[model samples]
Target: MHIENADLNLLKALDVLLEERHVSRAAARFHLSQSAMSRTLTRLRETFGDELLVRTTRGYELTPRARAIRQELEFILPRLRAMVRGGDFDPATSTDAIRVNCTDYAISILGPGLLPHVFERAPNLSLTIEPLSPRTYDEIEHGRVDLALSPVQPPAGLRWQPLFEEDYVGVVAADHPLTADRLTLDEIREFPRVSVVVLPQEQMVIDRRLAELGVAQRSGLRVPYFEAAFTALPGTRLIALVPRRLVEARRADHSVRLVEAPTELAAPFPYGMVWHPRLNSDPAHVWVRSKVGEVAAGLRPGTP
Candidate 1:
């Protein structure tokens, strides 16, 4: 049987390639081989009469035409998905994998409570938590990540839902000599510090807070995850200002202690969930996002 426009699938491939900007990674999204993806890109260029993607010294970039079409594709694709699915999600039966983009810190704070809530309703569904990366925004825009949680707001054309606010406190080794419920600027500056960087362009919010207080952070150690910062304090004078909740969660295992930082330091930064406009109305996406919001609400201070 001859299928009319079997090539329609190539349009889907084109959307992925345009967002990914890398043929290899785009291929991985569709589980296609590199050579096949390259051929697909060649076909897309032929169909659109544009280069579509061009290699640069740094990496591949979409051509102007490709970029222009993406804005329209983002609008059409989700509608097309909803049309095809044609029904509300049944969590008990659906086994779809929900890809979540977040830091380990969020998993530490929300996962313990969130998982039970999600599994109770959707035992067959699975959640895959991915670490934050520079490409997280792109991943969401392109449909790779179903949801994202971060302190930084994403670009426009995405939904941002404020989940909870967080504040920072200084953490030190449980056996450290300085025995204060709170530390002054002079005391904090006494030791070399460690910092957490989520991605290349992203620095932790506390970095700005520290600079505001004129506290010189001797960043002898820099790590990617929040928990790594505590490892510096075991037998050393090193201390860091991490989320108060994070410190409380890990204190028992790491033998770390949390104390109030200088009075100049403010309360917690606002962290939130973000998603692409394309996924905003998808039933399954909405259901999972609702569950996440519920979990975040219960985890806030003074909630029973």
Candidate 2:
């Protein structure tokens, strides 16, 4: 398709109609009368050589061609808006939604504090916290999310920036016996342990670290999320090996005690921010990444 002779106004009209999926709503979005919007839709059909949107019982539905082009519009419309607005990224004024994928641990440790800072800086900005799915690398590569924060290394073709290094700590109830003494690898291995089973990539790194230290323990329970692991610790005699930052965050609310693990078992678990190269130049994404890095820096060893 030769975009050189295309009507740019029609592109904007199509974008609004596709999003609203109704003539009246699309007219309201563009501040046009319903008749004007209908005319715009007709022009769009002629330009695209397709009905694009077909009426449905519930609402308007996109044809397969329209569905295929929806993502392209999502990507292109933002850039077009930026260009028309003189490419200014005024955080205080610009309203943008950023999608981020991360584990429950990252959200517990970093999300609470980071969100407020982001809102303060960019009040109009919205956030979508997506689950860190098994196919996270593919999600990042295909632009399903703006950024990903995880302990795993990024796959090829993606860029990774190290945010912070977390270390494993032994967590138990405040009155647990080992809270008074430094936790030894042998002692940790002897007791029932609550382990948070992450994705395969993270599991590989943790397993490698445990093997290096010869640390083997009987798993009392395996949970999918960190909050579950933390919740399981208050009543049981089970000890949980979790990130120190997470333990510190929950210390005030829960009567949990954090004991440093033996140096050999206290491997540095580095969490990083990964994004596709295509988004490397996106201003909003860069701003969000920088803010996340800043929050991570402040959460250093004992500050969380």
Candidate 3:
């Protein structure tokens, strides 16, 4: 098991390769030439005595050995980094780009409120906010996502803090007949629906609820964010069920009005921040996370 001139970069390379599961992508991450990366992969295989990434018809798949390696790395590396780097975090001087994986709904809720702080404190700070896609837990543990704001509950092994409970409401044109009063489930079911397309984690719950209610979004305007739903609802027969927070966020848009969904049809879920335990002691993460909690707490849940 002894090798000459063992370089730490090899382990780093293996880690990235297992994560990306694509040679070119991993090579780009390490800024290595394609042929150089291939040589590094060869060395990794020789050292580990396992084909860490085996190519499949669609793409590369990790062996169980690779998964074990990843788990080990996930346990050790970030905590080591945190120990070395942890300190008082001055948002004013922080230029590190904080990547938050979330839906547009989260962006609407967090970005504006956080930006003033981001600007006033960390003027050079850049925020990259994007949709929550598949393998969210893996992404968070691997440092691919610095934070997540999701309505969908976190999977086991991920740590989460519930920010607030949110209630769903029906929104339509200001003059839409459905706004005459709180909507009955029958009225909601009969309306042409504009569904909110969400991440994979949230998709199942949504689909299950819709199936149980026997309702379909017939308006044919399916969108990933509630903002799009707001845009679609005005001056049309389309009805959208979205978080009351969304209406509060975009109330100035003045394109739609919100009414309560029938009590039987609406369900409440907590939207919160989730992160990996590896980041537990990261000072910068702790500070911003607290700010997020403060914002979420102030946003008491109810009709906008």
Number of the top-ranking candidate, with lDDT as the measure? 1
lDDT (10s digit) by residue, model 1, range 118-220: 8998898757788989998988887767789998899988889999988888888888787988878888677777788888665568887777778777746
TM-score of every model? 0.72, 0.80, 0.69
Q: Summarize candidate 3's per-residue lDDT along 36-88 as a digit string, tens digits.
A: 99999899888888999999998999999999988676445544544656676
Q: In order, what is each prediction's RMSD in angstroms?
A: 7.0, 3.4, 6.3
Of 1 and 3, the candidate ahead on lDDT is 1
The sequence of per-residue lDDT tens digits that candidate 2 reaches over residues 1-304 is: 5677569878878877887789999999899999999999898887788899999898899988887677667656665666665646889986666778887888887877798889988998868887787887887776657788988888788999998887777788777766554677787778898877777445645556776777775769888788988888876788887777777777576577777766676557678999888877677877888899988888758432
Best by TM-score: 2
Candidate 1, poorest ten consecutive residues by summed lDDT? 1-10
* True-structure lDDT of candidate 1: 0.80
Model 3 alpha-carbon miss at residue 58, Å: 28
Candidate 3 lDDT for residue 79:
49
Evaluation by lDDT, superior candidate among 2 and 3 = 2
